[model samples]
Target: MKVEQIYTKCLAQGAYYIFSEGEAAIIDPLRETQPYIEKLEQDRAKLKYIFETHFHADFVSGHLDLSEKTGASIIYGPTAQPDFEAIIAEDNQIFEIGKIKIKVLHTPGHTLESATYLLIDENGKESAIFSGDTLFLGDVGRPDLAQKATNLTQEELAGMLYDSLYNKIIPLPDDITVYPAHGAGSACGKNMQKETIDTLGNQKRTNYALNQPDKEHFVVAVLDGLTPPPKYFGMNVSMNKKGYKSFHEVIKESYRALSPEQFENLATTESIVILDTREANVFKDGFIPNSINIGLKGSFAPWVGSILVNVQTPILLVCDKDTEREAITRLSRVGFDNVWGFLEDGIQSWKEAGKDLDKINRITAEEFAEEFTPDAVVVDVRKPSEYATEHVEGAYLKPLSDFEEWVKTVDKDKPFYIHCAGGYRSMIAASILKYNGITDFKEVDGGFGQIKKTKVPTTDFVCPSKL
Candidate 1:
């Protein structure tokens, strides 16, 4: 038997592949299906089932397309009402693949349909549990995401999560492996460990959620500091629950290569957005006017999902040469399937055409310190939690996630300086500020990380809870 964790770093999501005796099963797949198809071919296995823990909110699942192509049955836990066909398994129901058995443990907390799949090896010993969002290595999934759909308060969901963990999961074998759906960078859980896999015994001892004193305490702890879910989350969940456009169709429609003039005309004549997915530093040097830079180098998909709320927003890409497909694929992961096209030959084509360009003013942290005044306008685009912990003295907290709303308040005439923890988010902010015609600001090159190292005065670190 072979079990593989296919981890996508950008989304911080994990999908599992289990194979035994020429039969394979996929759990919680991404939007792209070709990779899984290729894996089946390589393993000489026929896919028998696709398992979904819940209707995911982060990225559209590949279950529909994978099942259609492979003739595999898509399975979900009880109480799931998907628009498409799927087998809703009861709690403790079991399915077999080769000599192994997969037992469904209905552990609904993250969502009403959430479940953990228990894998029993050929020797009939419990080998591992694909815990989904029900349990992460260090933390449990946040209860707030499914509140509206379930009509249950986050505290109630948290209580259910505690029950799911304590009654259904904690009694399992200590040595069994625990494979969760997400890790540290994911918005699914606030305090997940960086490690994707851990032993159940280790988790019992180390995971804070698992060690809660009682259900009430667990509910309070789990609901402590959840920021709002990304704007695209609900849209992605809808796409997953209902069916979505085939990835093939999305790719075919999005692969159009537009000439510089065509790209410019589209940007000017239509309501389409220009998304420049280059490196932040390179983007700051120069880019097309009004292009929002959510660079491919950072948490590109989540940032895009947060900033661009509408899934159907038409987008034209200004990517580095050869990264157009990657940008489109990443965008599609979050249900952004309306990519109009990419600028053919990239920004160089526009430069050659002598089209107008825009650049953001940026300065090193040292330079910013030397030029700093006590009352200079400083914008910290880090999250409120980060800001509350410590920030430059007198810096205004305007998180990048809420850039669209807060950006409107920036005065066009006032010169300001903006920074994030590192340069990535600040560059994104710089691009948006320029796009909004507020170009009098300077972005700190290294963000707060470097600013704190300089002579720039920062407030003493304060715990987020206190604020």
Candidate 2:
């Protein structure tokens, strides 16, 4: 029994390719299926099955496309309502592909249709389980996402989750490696382990979800820390059910280079999307107008996957010359293969081309303190809990997740200053402001941490000031 884990970093997703004898099976494939196709061809294995753990809401799945291309059957739990032809998998249903025996286990908590696949070797012993979102390395899937419309509350689903974890996942042998569909930065699970794979034994000892036997407490704990789902989640989920758009037959070769004038023309014509992969502060200082800012600092792939869905859209990358390959590889992880080209010499190329650049206004903590006025709106773009723990006096709490809608709530004419825990999110917030036509905005140079470090005078808006 040979198994390979295909990690798609852009979506924080992992798919399994199981090969034995002359057959191959893929579990939880991403929207782009070419990589899998190339792998199968290279291995000389005929594709036999494509499985989806659930109707994913985070990123589009590629089961349908693979099935269409390879004449392979698509498999999902019975409760799943995928539009294309699919085998309704049931508990204990066994199937054979080459030398591997696959068994499906219904694990319903992440969604109504979630399932875990147990792989048995030709010798009849369990080898691994593709846990999908039901069980991650360090965290269990969040129950709130798929429960929004159903009569079942998060509490009710969490109870089901407890049963599934204790009854099905726990009873398996400790050595059976648990391969989840997602990892860190995935919205499906909070506090997901950074590692892509872990054994059941390790997860049992270290994962908080597995340690808690008290169902009530477990339910409360998992439900409490979930971040808001991305704005594109609903559209992605709906499209997945109907199946994704067809993958183009022609794979365009990635652009090797582009002159600054050519890049500027592409941006102006809206023929290509400019991706600034520089540090957030660098981007905030100055960037080409209308470019989307996704810094290379943290979770670059998942955030890019969340915001940019059109895989074929031509991309113009802007990064320091040193980080260009890192940017390309990150984009490739999410299957964004239609890169038109990268800016030559990065932003310096634009300077040489004499292209116009836009700069975001930034102010120091001391300057913000002196200019602070009731009418000058201050926005906190950190997490809600962070804002609650500490914040500038009278500043409106508008998390970066809530930024777009939050912008509407504020008076557009009022000048605004934005800050987060540090400078990263402030720059993101600033770029979002620029895109939304909010120009009279100043981002705090060092963010809230700097404000605290400088001991700038701040009144407590939520609590009385100590000083």
Candidate 3:
């Protein structure tokens, strides 16, 4: 028997592949399905099932396409009213894959249809539980995402989550491995551990949510500090539930190579966005005018999902030549299937074609330190938690996560200095600021990371309530 956790770092999502004897099953796959198909072929295993814990809001799952192509039965837990054909397994229903068994433990908290699949090894032991969003290593899934679908309040869902954990999950074997669908950096859960895999015993002992046996305390502990989920979440969930264009089709449409001239023409003529996926530093030096820079390096899909807002926005890409497919894939992961094409040969082709480029005015952290004044506006774009930890003295807090509201109240004409933890987020802020007609700002090149190294005044002061 082989169990593999195929983890995607950018989305912080994990898909599982379980195989034994001659059959295999995939649990909670990502947008692209070719990798799983190839895996089955290589292992000489018959694809038997495509199992989904719930309709994912963050990324479109490949269950539909995988089932269609492989003739595998798509399985969902009880109460799943999917538009497409699927076997809605009953609570505690068991399915056999070769010599092993997978038992469904209906644990709905993150969403109404959520379930954790328990893998009973060939030895008939509860070896691991693919906990889905029901349980993370250090946290439980946020219960707010399903309010619209279930007409249930977040508080009510939190109560259900507490019951799910306490009654269904906590009773599992101590040595059973726990594999959650998402890890840290995912909005699915608040404060998830960085580690993707952990034993149930360790989670029971260490996870804060598990420590609180009382339902009231558990609900509050799970719901605390959860900001609103990204706007595209519901849209992604809809696509996952209804149906979507094949990954093959989306990739074919988006991975086209457009010459610099063609790329410029499309950007100007159509209502398309030119997304620059180059490094933030490289983008600051040169980029297509008005192109948004959410580098492919860090939280690219989620940032694109949040910052871009409209998933239907037509998009063109400026990527490192060989990475066009990667850029296309990440955009599709967040349900941005309208991506048209990529800048052929990257920024070099644009330069070779003698097209005009726009650049940001960036100053080093040391320069920002030396030129700072108490009256001058400085915006720190990190999270509130990061700000509370320590930030430059007098830096007005405006996190990039809530940029839409923050940008509205800012004085457009006022010149300010913006910095995030690193330069990546600040550059993203710069592009959005430009789009909103506020461009009189300088980005601190190395951001607060370098700013902390300078002689800038810093503080760890927190509000009285948090204290």
Candidate 4:
């Protein structure tokens, strides 16, 4: 028997592949089906089932396309009301794949239809549990995401999560491996560990969510410090539940190459957004005027989804020649399917065509330190928690995730400095600021990481409650 965890670092998501005796099963696949199809061909195994823990809110699932191509039955836990055909397995129901068995453990509260799949090896010993969002290595799924759909308050959902963990999951064998759907950097859980896999016994002892004394404590602890989820979450969930355009179709339509003049015309004539997906350093040097920069090297999809909240927004790409396909694919993963086309031959083509170019003013951390003034306006684009930990004493806390809303209040005439934990998010903020015509600001290169190393005064780490 072989079990593999296919981890995508940018999304911080894991999809599992289990094989035994020439039969294979896939759990929580991504939007593309070609990779899985290739895996099956390589192993010479026939896929029998595709398991979904719940309707995912982060990225569209490939269950429909995978099942259609392979004739595999798509399985979901009880209470799933998908528009497409799927077998809704009952709690404790078991399915066979060659010599191994997969038992369904209905564990809702991440969503009403969440479940964990327990793998019973050929030896009939419980071996591993694919603990979806129901349980993470150091934290459990946030309960607030399902509130509107279920008409349940977050507290009530948190209570249900507590019961799901205590009654359904905690009783599992200590030595059994725990494979979760997401790791750190995912919005699904606030405090997930960086490690993707852990032993159940270790989690029981080390995970704060698993060690809660009672359900009340568990609910309170899990709900604490959760920022609002990205606006694109519900749209992705809807697409997952109701099915979407095939991944192949999205790529085929969006991969069209546009000349510099055509790309410029599209941006001027249509209500389209220009998304530049080069690296932050490359993008800051030169880019299309008024384009938003969410670099492909960083958390590209999530940042795109957060800033461009509407999935249906029309977009034109300005990417490195090699990254155009990847830009479109990643955008489609987050339900951004209205991508029109990409600038052919990248920024060089635009330059050759004598198109107007825009650039951001950036300064080194040491330069910022020398120029620092007690009353100078400084904007910190890191998250709330990071700011609470330690930030420049009087820096304005305008987090990059909430850039759209806070950007409206920027004083275009006033000059300020902006920074994030590192340079990635601050560059994104800088591009957005430039796009909005707020150009009097300079972005601090190396961000707070380098700023903290300088003589600039920063607040000592303060307890969150005191802030």
Candidate 5:
């Protein structure tokens, strides 16, 4: 038996390809099915099964598309409510192909229908378990995702997770390998280990979730530090369950490259969403007016998922020529396929076309201190946990993710200055404000790092140094 791990860095997701003899099964595929198809074709393997551990909330899954294309059976746990054709996998249901045995284990904590699949060699020795989101290398899935309207509270869900971990997963042999769906930077769980795969023994020894003495403490530990889910989570979950629209079916609408004059005209004619994929600092220094800044620096897809609602809405791309493919690919990962082509030569093209550009005010920490007044509202746009750590004194904490709500509570007319840990997120927050017509604002040049270097009376809260 041969096992291959396919990692999609854009979505921070992984899919597995298992081959026994000439038959293959794909587990938890992403929306883009081309890569898997190409692999199977090259290997000369018949596609037999497409398995979904659960309906993913973070991104769309490609179970339906692969099944439709390859005439493969779509399989999920008994409680799953997939809209397309699928077989309900029963607990301990075993299937064999070539030299491998696939056994389904119904592990429901991350979601009601979540399953962990065990792979065994022909000799009956367990090799690895596709643990899905129920268990990760260092952390467990956050229990709040599927409990929005359910009778189960966060505590109840976490308690279920403890059982799923201790009762179902922990009993597996120490040397059995564990492969999960998501890795670091995934909102599916807090503190996911940077490594993609780990042994059950390693995790049992070092994983904090597993080290907890009892279920009650374990429940509190996992539930306490979770960030709020992205706005598009529910939409993605529902879309995945209903079977995501196939990527092949997405029509590539032809769009003419806009001349500078035409681009300006479109911007003025109606509200056009301009997505600038440059670094945050560059965007803050100068950019086209009314553009929503989503830098390619970190987790661009999830942030785009949070702000964008209409996938069909026209988007004008503003990126360096070298990053065009990356920009398009990342957007497509989240099903944002309405890219109306890129600027012919990127921002340089627009500048050469003699279009008017806008500049955002930026000030250094020392300069900001000189201009500081009690009336000036200083906002920190980092995460709440980051804010709880060292932050500028007297600055109101409004993380970039929750900036929309925080903006409403502040007096828009007041002079405002914003900064993140680095300068990056501050630019994003500034762009968001500018897009909403909050014009009188400035972003700190070096952000908190620069501010901390200077002598200042600030309260420091303990947090992980890596962040």
Candidate 6:
């Protein structure tokens, strides 16, 4: 038997592939389907089933495309009614794959359809359970996301979660391994561990949610500090449930390459967004006017999902040569598949053509401290938690997730100094600010990380004094 956890770090998501005796199963695949298809071909196995934990809100699942491509049956747990055809499995149902059996344990409350798949080895020993959002290593999936679907309050879902964990998961043997769907960075759970895979015994001991005082306290603990999910989450969930365009079709439609003039013409004609996927430093030096710089080097998909609320928003790319496909793929992973084309030959071609360009003013943290004045406006573009923990004195919080809304309050005529924990987010902020006609601002070179190291006054709650 062979089992592999196919982890994608950018989304902090994990998909599983299990195979034995020429039969294979895929659990919660991403939007891209080629990798899974190729895996089966390489393993000399046939895909028999595609298991979906629930209607995911973080990213689009590849279940539909994989089913259509490989003729595999898609399976979901009880209470799931997808727009596409799928087997609505029962609470204790079991399916055979090769030499092993996959027992479906209906573990709802992450969503009513959430299921944990127990892999029983050929010898009939329980090997591992793929505990999809129902149970994370140190946390559990948030209860709020299910309110819209079940018309049940988060508290009700949390109660259901309590029952599910106690009855379905906690009763399992301690020796079995637990592989959860997401890790720390994911919005699915409030306090997930960085580790994706852990043993059931260790989790019972270490996980806060697993050792709650009671169901009432568990509900309160889990529901306490969940920030609003990204603007694209609901849209992605709808796409997952109602069905979406094929990944192949999205790729085919998005692969067009246009010359600089043609790209400019299309951008102007359609009023489509220009997304520059270059390094933050390169983007800051010079970029296409009004293009939003979300570097491909970081958590590109989640950032795009946060800033661009509409998944179907038409986008044009100004990416480095040969990187267009990657940018398009990452965008598609987050359900943004309407990429019209990319700038051919990169920004150099446009530069050579004498096209107009825009640049953001940036300064090193030390330099910013030296040039600082009493009334100078400073913006901390990190999350509220980050800012509240510690930030430069007098820096107003403007988290990048809600850049569009928070930025409205910034004076149109006055310049502001903006920074994130590091340079990446601030560069993204600068690009968006430029796009929205708020260009008179400077980006702190290394963000608060460097600013805190300088003599600049930084504090939490109330700033005490300038260092």
Model 4 agreement with the true structure over 33-79: per-residue lDDT tens digits: 99999999999999999999999999888999999999999999999
Better of 1 and 3 by TM-score: 1
Q: Which residue runs does candidate 5 get wrong by more than 4 Å?
A: 148-151, 254-256, 265-272, 309-314, 364-376, 465-467
Per residue, candidate 5 scores C-alpha lDDT tens digits across 75-140 of 897688777779999988987767788899988878878889999987899989998888887888
Tens digit per residue, CA lDDT, model 3, 1-467: 99999999999999999999989999999989999989999999999998999999999899988998899999998899888999999999999999999999999888889999999999999999999899999989999999999999999999998999999999998999998999999988868889999999999999989999599988887888888898989999999889899999998887799988788889985667889999988898898888999999999999999988788999989998688899888898889999888888899999999999888889999999898877778899987777877888888998898997989888878899999988989999998887677878999998888988888888865662362
Which is the leading candidate under TM-score? 4
Q: Give the TM-score of candidate 6.
A: 0.96
Clashes of each: 0, 0, 0, 0, 0, 0
Per-model TM against the reference:
0.97, 0.78, 0.97, 0.98, 0.90, 0.96
With a 3 Å backbone cut-off (N, CA, C), the pairs that clash in candidate 1 are none
- Give lDDT per model, in order: 0.92, 0.79, 0.90, 0.93, 0.80, 0.90
Better of 3 and 4 by TM-score: 4
lDDT of 3 at 221: 79
RMSD (Cα, Å) for all candidates, in order, is 1.4, 5.3, 1.8, 1.4, 2.9, 2.8
Local lDDT at 320 for model 4: 87
Weakest ten-residue segment in model 4 by summed lDDT: 458-467
Q: Give per-residue lDDT, candidate 4, residue 124.
A: 99
lDDT for 341 in candidate 1 is: 97
Least well predicted 10-residue stretch by lDDT in candidate 3:
458-467
The list of candidate 2 runs beyond 4 A from truth reads 148-151, 249-282, 296-355, 362-378, 385-396, 411-417, 444-467
**Higher-ranked by TM-score: 2 or 4:** 4
Report model 5's TM-score to 2 decimal places.
0.90
**Tens-place lDDT digits, model 6, residues 22-122:** 99999999999999989999999999999999989999999999999999999999999999899999988999999999999999898999999999999
